[model samples]
Every structure is written in C-alpha cells, then in structure tokens.
Target: MKIKLRHLAGKVFLSLILISGLSTPISAQNLISNGDFETWEGISTDTGLDKGIPAGWTSQTGDGNLTLYRTGTPHKGNYSVFARNTSGNVSRMFTPTLQPLSAGKMYKLTFYTRGKGTLANITLTENGEKLNGAVATSPSDKNIFASPSMLNKEYNNGKEWEKQEYTFTIQTDGIYKLIFWPKSTAGTDGETSDYFLLDDIELVEFVDETICTLSEIIVKGSTLKEFDPGILTYNITLAKGAAIPKVTATPADTKASVKITAATKIDGTEPERTTTINVTAADGISTREYKIIFEESNEILREGFASEDRPEKFTYPNKTNWIIDANAAQNNGVFFGNNSIRPKGSDFTDDYFTIDNCTSAGILSFYLKNRGDNANAILTVSYQKTSDSNNWIELKTIPDSEIGTSYEKISLPINSGEPVNIKFHIQKTAGLIGYNIDDISLTPFIATKQENEKTGKDIVFANGNTIHLQTSIPTNYTLYNINGQICTTGNVSGEYTLSVDTAGMYIISLQNANGKSVHKIIIP
Candidate 1:
C-alpha cells in the first residue's frame, strides 16, 4: 500500500498503499527437445539428417534459394538458427517428431527472434509433411499445415530480440512438425533477401488448475476500472487474525469507491474469514458478478491473453510511406479520416507489400472493400509473431483469399507483447488494383482460454492513472507501462490516494500471497 501525503498549509492528508510480471511457472517444461539449436556439435549428414544442423532438425531448400545455417544470435544459449532467402525459391526446416502431442489439449509455442530483411515463417504441419522420416523443406501437399489460428510464427523486428507466443488446441492425435522458411522480398537478389535468427523455441501446454483462468481477486481497497472478468467464481479465504476481512462494503466495478475505508478488518475471531473476492465483467453500463471461495488462500489471478508479455496500443502511423495510387482506389479512414490504399501489382505472384509491426494482444482490424477484379483481387496476409509472432521464432505466409466489394471487416490476429511486421500482399492483382480500405485500426483484446488444469493465469488491466490495490496479503508490487518502462512501486496493502503528477500511461503489478496481478493506467 502507498501512502500519499499532501501538505496543505498546516493540515496533512495521509493515504496508504501495496505493490509486481509475467511470472514463469515454477514448473514449465518444453515439449520440443533440442529446441535451442546449441547441440550442433560434430553433427553431420553422414546418415540422413542435414549436416552441420542441430540434431532433431532437418532442412530442405527447393530450387536453392533459402539456406538454414547456424547463427551467433540466440535468445537462450550461444547457438541459434540463421535463415536466408534469396531470389524466389523455397526453403523449409522441420522438427523431428516421431510421437504425437496430446490431442484435445491447449499448447503454446514461443521463441525469441530478429531479422534483417524479409522473413518467411515457421509453421506446424502434419506428419506427412516430412519426406519419409525427415521433414521436407517445402511440403508439396498444402493440406499438411494446420489452420491459420493454430500456427505460431515469428518475423523481423529491427536488431532487437523479441519473444512470441501462440496458443492453440490440438485437433487430433497426430505427429506435428515445425517448418521454418525464410522468404525473399519479391525474390529479387540483394533487393531484400530476408534472413532471421531464432533461439529457444518452446511449445508447452498452458494449464493452471485449481484457479479460474478468467477471474481475479481484488480487495475493496483496489480499483478495477474498465475491466473484464471472463470466468466467475467466489474464493472464500480465511483472513487469519483480522476482523471484518479488512473490508467495509464491496465497491466492485458497479459500487463506488467512496464506500471502502480502512477501519474494516478480517473477521479476526470468526476462525474462517470470508474475504469476498468479487469478479466483475463490467461493460460500462452494466456488470456481471461471480463469487468464488478460497478455503485457505489469499488472492488468485488468471488470464488467457498473458497481457504482461503482450501490450495493447492504438496508433495512426505516418502515411507518407504508404503506397497510394489512383488505380488502387485509396481513401481515408472511416474514423480518423486518414488515407488507406490497396496493393498494386500485375502478375500472379506479384509482391506488392510492406513489412510493419503489430505489437500487442489484439487484431489488426480494418474496413476493406474489393475494388479490382472480382475473382482475382486477393488478400494474402502473412505475419510473424505469436499465433503469428512469438516475438520472432515462427513465420507464416497465410494462403490468399478473395474479398468482394461489400466493405467487409478484416481482422488479422496478433500475439501479445511480441509484435510482428505484417505483409499484405496482393497475390493476383490481375493487371488491376486491390482493396479499398479504411479504419486501419487495432484493439488490445484478451484471448483467455479456460483449459482445465492450466498453469500461469494472467491478469492485465488497461492503461490508467488512478491508484487502487487489492489484498491485505503482503507481496511485491510494481508499476510500469506497455513499453517495459518502470514507474513507481512498493510493498504494502490498503487504500491509497495516488498522485499521478504526470500525464502518462503506467502498469501496476501486484504480487501478493496468491500470484501476480498487472494493471495498466493512463494518466491524463
């Protein structure tokens, strides 16, 4: 709890407070063996696998344009993978997996990566994608890969290391392989031969049982503004040695904060003090509340989005670099009145696209309408990150699709924290233009999945400035922003009158007896 002190002439107003991340589970095991390409010691292709490559990994370069070799950059150990693609040929690397992951379970793939130029993607494919036992660099059958939603990828993000994570549900009990392919930008040599560095590739099942993956506990002293609680449960914990459970009345998302005071205490003599943990799914006008019981615990926080690692942001980037043309039928955004243009190309495999960053847990949603040929005006959305950006270990060139002139909604999912540079290519412009777009927008949203027996439940709040805290159970707390910048923090619990002197956005982390709870606040 933080104590805000304001000296006014002679009178002094005193208020008190408590103060914490994305916690790595005490027990997290990577399913992929030798995911870090550090074991390439004297490994040769004398038998079957590729020479000089790490064990349990094989690469294939069709038409000899892409090459997968060892890199000095790594997110973990000293060794990593370097992928370079020149011209327009294809190169793919596959993971050795004679066994199948448990089906019906949720799996998360994460890795750290960076790139110099255009990058391809790392995809999850069926067992047959491998030519017999080794993974094929270019799988002939397009049906071998999983759906777009299940793929975790990475992309180039300057020279810095970025982490990406993707969560998906296993469909069937089949062997899954990871294929890495670095793609050339327009297949022009020296124009943009993309090369990427990857290290510490990991895929794990996210399961945290005994805790709801959507609910969080906040004492009346805490402030939950503009929040959404996915699952509802009441955790009745024994606030040992306190009276009234340190609460006056429940001032949840609906109730006002004025009702909470410091006089209240846990039901000291009541033996079992029920510190009413309220869950709120408030939507401004109305709220839905759920009650949960904690027999012998303090606080609990669970989230599917892992917002601490992934942040949310809204921006209107510079429009000068955007390729705008009359043939493309460009227009301003429906909301901001900003300009938007479609891709222009001529051939079947025309590469008319640019690489841009998508940082956070949300969707790159926009208003789009086809303006070119009815059957040929296609949209090929390829991204690198969790789902599409694990900061940068995976990559994908999503299949193309046709969009008509109905002004439809186009949303491309992005990973939290690990933002990927996306490419919107017009596969078949057909000697014409592409899409008429507007409202180039993005929203940081939560993708919380309630998988039974999951681990590491996360809770992240939107950006704000008002300071409020929950839980009398003491632990460490910290306040930062979406950019990983630390602000203010302390270790205490109670009511606090925060003096957000500056108008800036910040995130508050509360790590108490239960777990860690992160809150984002913007000071205006």
Candidate 2:
C-alpha cells in the first residue's frame, strides 16, 4: 500500500495513514546491503550468469546476451553498475532478498540512475507475486505511478544523474526482491547497444512526522494586509506612537507547539521592529518560522488601480492614452489588485503623477511587464521637481535586457526631498502592444533631525540667461539647463554670476556648511 501525503493551507493531511492504522518508527537504517554497486567479485565478460555482477545483485536477460560491468563513473562513491543489452530482448537487474518487512510498516526506496536506453519500469515481488500500490516520485516531473503491479516511471536524465524514490507498504510479512528493467518491454524488438547506469540505491523505513507549519497568525493591534501560509514574511504598518501588537500563531498539527518572540516596545526611535514565531512539530525534529515586521507607515503614495478608470493622483496630459484594464490576464498583463493600466493606443504618449511636499528622499517602486509580442516599445521613467523648471531626470527604461515577459519589480532611488512629479513616457515604435504597469508605490526615507535641517537660506536668481547667487559662506554652485545638462560649476563666496548662452528655465544648486539648497530661475 502507498500512502500519499497531501497538503492544504500549510497543513499535512494524514487521513489515509490514520484510517489504515499504519505507522512506522522514526529511526531506521538502509535495508538493502551492497546497494551502492561498489563491491564486484568477478571478472566481466561479453556474456555470462556468473560474470562481473555487483555483490548481492543478479540480472535476467531473455537469451543471456546482456553484459554487466563495474564502471568507475559513478554519481557518488567509487563505482557504479553498468548494463548493456546486445540482443533485442529486455534485460533487468535484481536486488538481493530484502530483510523481512512488517505487514503494515511503510518503506521507502531511492536510487540515482542515468543512461540512454528506455528504463521501462520497477517492480517488487515475492515468490513471483507482485506487490500492489507502490508510489514513485521524481523531482524532474510529477508522480507517474499509475499501475499497482508495476511502476512505469521513466526518467530520461541523458548522462546526468537524477534521483528517484518509491514508497510502499506490504500487506503480508515476507521477503521481497526489487527489479529494475533497463529496456522497454513492448518495443525495441531490433534495438541493440542500449545501456543503463545505476548507483546509490537505498531502502529505509519512512515515518511522516515532519509537519510543523502554521495555519494562521494573528496580530492584536492591527489587521494583516494579507495572509498566506506559504508566505512566511509580512510587513505591517502601525500608526505613529501606537503600541506594539500582541502576536499569536496557530500550528497546523495539534501536536505541534509554537513559540512567539514578541516585540516589547515601540518607542518611535526605530523605524521598524521584527517579531519571529517558531513552530516545532510533534517529532521535535521538524521546524518552521514566520516573521512579522512592524513598521511606521510613511507612505507618500500608493496606487493599485482598484476601481478608478485612471489613477486619482495621475494626470494624463495626452487625455486619451492609458485606460484601466480589468482583464489583465487576457492581455498577458500582470496585476496585483483588480486591474492595471495599459496604453489605449499604440502611440507615443506621456503621463505623470505628482506627490507634493515630499520632505525626505525616497524609493519609487512599481511593477512593469512587457507584452510577449512587443517590438521596440520603450517605457521611460523619469522624475523632476514641480517647482523647478528643469527636464525630467531619467531613472530607468523598461523592456531592456533585464526585463522578462512577466511583471518585474522596478525600483529607483529618488535622491531629492523636493515636491516632485514622476512621469511615465511610452514610445511605441512599431508594434501595437505596449507595456503594462501596476502597483505603484513610493516610500520616503527615514531621516534624523540633523539630516532634515541640512538646507540653508541662500539668495539665488536668474536674470536673462545669467544666474547670480549670494552666499553667506564659501559654497560650491552648479547651474543646469532645462534638459538637466550642466551649464557651469564653480566655487564662490559673496556675489557670483554665471552667464549662459541659452534662453530657457534653469536650476541652480548651492552646497556649503549648512548643507545643500536648490532654486529655480527662468531666463527669457
């Protein structure tokens, strides 16, 4: 009998084992002797029954045409068993008589194999009677144990060793033999020179007592933004000056125990506090951990496009550009909420969102995904201060080599604390499909009082195409054009003047002992 353990909501369901009244001990050793094929006692020949077979192993070839040898190429250790079929008949290798297994005890068989021939099936038999209901598992693919009499599991590892495992329980107390068929039974009537490499075979008693996952975690002071057993880490925002919440974790198994390391205090000194929950299963060997991060939420703006036709804080200067796409999946777009935004037309357009009175530097992050058929469509992200008359500073361009078909998180560093406007410009070149954007967020940098008081008073103005600055102390000044191109830079004290050859809006930045300050001026 094969007992398969299925999981739901991080809880392992052992109903099959409980209903059958079958349990195995936790400690057991490998029952297959000389299973590694490392002990060969005879010389290898072209064909024979007593030829170079590994100790405790035998083979069956219909007309005695299969050749066996010990090879130095092994997945591990020093040697592995290699079998070659010279005739059209199927060949198989057999294990020695296994130690007697209990009637209701579960056993697990595992081995590493690699080769070219079609490894057809594996079977366990006692006195020519096949054992039923064995389950085979492989990491390369899903479980393919369909028949009870024979396990038709084949892995085409092709020169690379792959591990395979099987689990089953015997209905009667008896000694058994395990067989490995190297060639398919039905086909290959005229096939020859087919080969198989086998190594690292093991059989042990299996006990399923390693389920220590939590079903649910609760916080007393605030609600979780989302909860999923598979997601172990979560970020929660607490109101400023609010006390840290009490946390409780519930294990999936009743026999499992949980320990919580709660945060003792929230004094607003640190930006965040981390709490951890550890769960230990009944066996005391299996464990899992979940973490909660409590942070003072200082979000500047967050847009998920839940219901708005367009983002509320966003302004579409082109007026008829992007629209809320409810069916993001149909268009191969990725979204976190109910919807995302995609270009309504395949034309070059610019759109922007503004955040006012931004007093600290921040990180701007969003999700962007390109259409699979997108061709030469470029999306550029840029930012500029609303009060300054300067061109947008380019942050990133999507659809580059780094972007994939699925939504990828794009994070950019915003170095300024000034009130700013962020722009997303899409230049659709040839293809009608463009990029999709969703889950836009901005988080300001936490600053100390000393860092926040860096800006000092300075007189800066522009007359015609010349910029003038009067500083109280020696300072370094840089003048830039509307396109963010540097016009001039120098160190000056008292009165300073810089004459430029262009006629447009400019920005002048001054840095001194007090710190850095930026000013905007127009030269018309």
Models 1 onward score TM values of 0.34, 0.35
- Over 4 Å off in model 1, which ranges? 1-27, 41-51, 117-119, 130-154, 185-195, 208-524
Assess each prediction's global lDDT (C-alpha) against the native: 0.46, 0.61
Indicate the TM-score of model 1: 0.34
Which 10-residue span in candidate 2 carries the lowest summed lDDT?
Answer: 133-142
For candidate 2, the lDDT comes to: 0.61
Best by TM-score: 2
lDDT of 1 by residue, 35-131 (tens): 9888874544422323366778776775445555665556667878766555544466668674466666656667766665443445566666434
266: Cα error in model 1, Å: 22
lDDT of 2 at 58: 78
lDDT of 1 at 201: 86
